[model samples]
Target: MEAATKPKLRVATTSLAGCFGCHMSFLDIDERLFDLVKLVEFDRSPLTDIKHCGPCDIGIIEGGLCNAENVHVLREFRANCKTLIAIGACAVNGGLPAQRNHLSLASILEEVYHAQHGLVDGFIPNDPELPLPLDKVHPIHEVVKVDYFIPGCPPSGDAIWKVLTDLLAGREPELGHGLIHYD
Candidate 1:
């Protein structure tokens, strides 16, 4: 009798404070994404158009937490995914967004809005539709336990592929010196 084939792993992904560059890098895998699709199914990712994540085997977070919504999504992913990987410098250490951490939120807001010379009814936005900004941006690990980290301003596609394939094979991922970097 032939051995039964294993089911594809369900994966979820999200971006927080940083740019969606990490997702772009994932897409940089080019034609190899077809191979990834064969190994895993996406849930609650921009690629899948899923509104919310259901039970998932892996979660890939690509940015840092900068607001209440990011916290909510990160917590939700933690609850749903058995293994979570922080991908890119943002998710691993707050990246560029965390640069504002040295300043008070009010000062940062003022610098962006009040300090601007544009003439208008300048006022801090308080729309309910917008997620409330946190006092400071934080890495994903500060909010939830991350099983793995892929370092880089945006990790290269090859680095991401290695991590994914290693996880699928149930082995501890070993990133080479070339792959371990923060830009």
Candidate 2:
């Protein structure tokens, strides 16, 4: 009889508010992705085009919460995945999106839609189809329990690879000085 092979781990990834730089960095894993594929299966990631996340072994999320939709998705993701990792500065501390924290949402919306010189009768969008905006942007931790955090504006591909590899090997991820970077 042939020996049964171990089931591959299921990994999912998502982005919330900030720019998609972190996902770009993840793609920078480049050729090594082939090796990664052997050990894990992608779930609800952009790479898979799967809209809804199923049960997953690990969920990697980037960006901060900016709207009601973001919170809903993050909560759902947290419920579906056993281990959750918050990646990039936005996920860790709200990053560039949290810059609006100092300003009122109403003022910001007015400045963007009403005061801009583009149109004659611009107004803030109030359509129910749109996700309701939050008064302040918030990090993932503020909304859900996060297991691990990979810091950096968008953590380098090498750092991501290290963390994933360590987790896969059942070892605690350790970012040495060389692997930990902000830029």
Candidate 3:
């Protein structure tokens, strides 16, 4: 009997408690991205209208979970995706958002818009729909078992391309360490 042909890999990417800059960086791959599309298919991502996790082989998460919603999304992705990659410093180490975590979320909000800025007329509603306070902006590994991480303030398009290529080729995606990461 012949072995079944491996399915073309499906991919999904999402951002959590981040600026969505890394997702833009991924699109900045441009024409080079065309090469990757041939091998893999994109599913649920902020870039796509698709809102829920479908069948996916790889999940590329670009930010850290800073709230209850983020945690829910991460867990959903983890449950669905075969391999999970944490992309960018925010996802890898919480990035700049971690800085604000020094103070309570309410305090930070008040300091920024109410006290110092003097927006007393404005109300800061701590609604359930709003993101919950983060104890700290932790890396993806802190929340879940991430299969891989590409750590950078924002990883370059070339680096993202290389990671995909290496993984597709069935080799360890050597996205460098320290300086030339994954080169």
Candidate 4:
């Protein structure tokens, strides 16, 4: 009789309010992705192109919260994921999107829509179809419990791989000095 193989772990990922740089870095794993697939299956990620997240063993989220939609997604993702990792500076601290926090939303909207040189009928959008913007951007931790954080503008593929491997082995993830980076 053939030995039964263990089921692969299910992992999902999403981006909320920043550039998709972190996901780009994840792609830096390159051909190692083939190896990764042997141990895990992607769920609700760009890899799978699945819109809704089902229950998952791990969820990797990048970017910060900037709107009601983002909050809803984060909460739903948290509920569906057994382990959630917040990756990149944006997910860790609100990153560049949080720069808008220094200014009032009204003023920013006014300047962009009403005061700009464009001569058309400029007004703030009030359509219910639009996701409501938040007063300030927020890190994922502010709105949901996060199991782990990978700190970097976009953490290198090696760092991400290390953390993932450690978790898969049921060990605490530890980054060496060489793997840790801010750029």
lDDT, candidate 1, 1-183, per-residue tens: 111266878999988776999999999889998888887889999877798889999999999999999999999999999999999999999998898898999987886777778836677878999999999999999989999999998899889989998888888998898887798
Candidate 4, 1-183: lDDT as tens digits: 111287889999999986889999999999998788888899998767799889999999999999999999899899999999999989999988899999999998899888889847999998999999999999999999999999898999989999998998899999989888766
**Candidate 4 ranges with C-alpha deviation above 4 Å:** 1-4
lDDT of 2 by residue, 2-119 (tens): 1127788899999999688999999899999988888889999877789999999999999999999999989989999999999999999999889999999999999999998885
What's the CA error at residue 64 for candidate 3, in Å? 1.1
C-alpha positional error of residue 183 in candidate 2 after TM-score superposition, expressed in Å = 3.5
> Residues 4-50, candidate 3, lDDT per residue (tens digit)?
25556899999987788788878879997777776777899876799
Q: Estimate each model's TM-score.
A: 0.95, 0.95, 0.88, 0.93
Candidate 2: stretches off by over 4 Å: 1-4
User: How many residue pairs collide in each prediction?
Assistant: 0, 0, 5, 0
User: What C-alpha lDDT do the candidate models reach, one value each?
Assistant: 0.90, 0.92, 0.80, 0.91
Looking at model 4, report the run of 10 residues with the lowest lDDT sum: 1-10
Displacement of the residue 17 alpha carbon in candidate 4, Å:
0.6
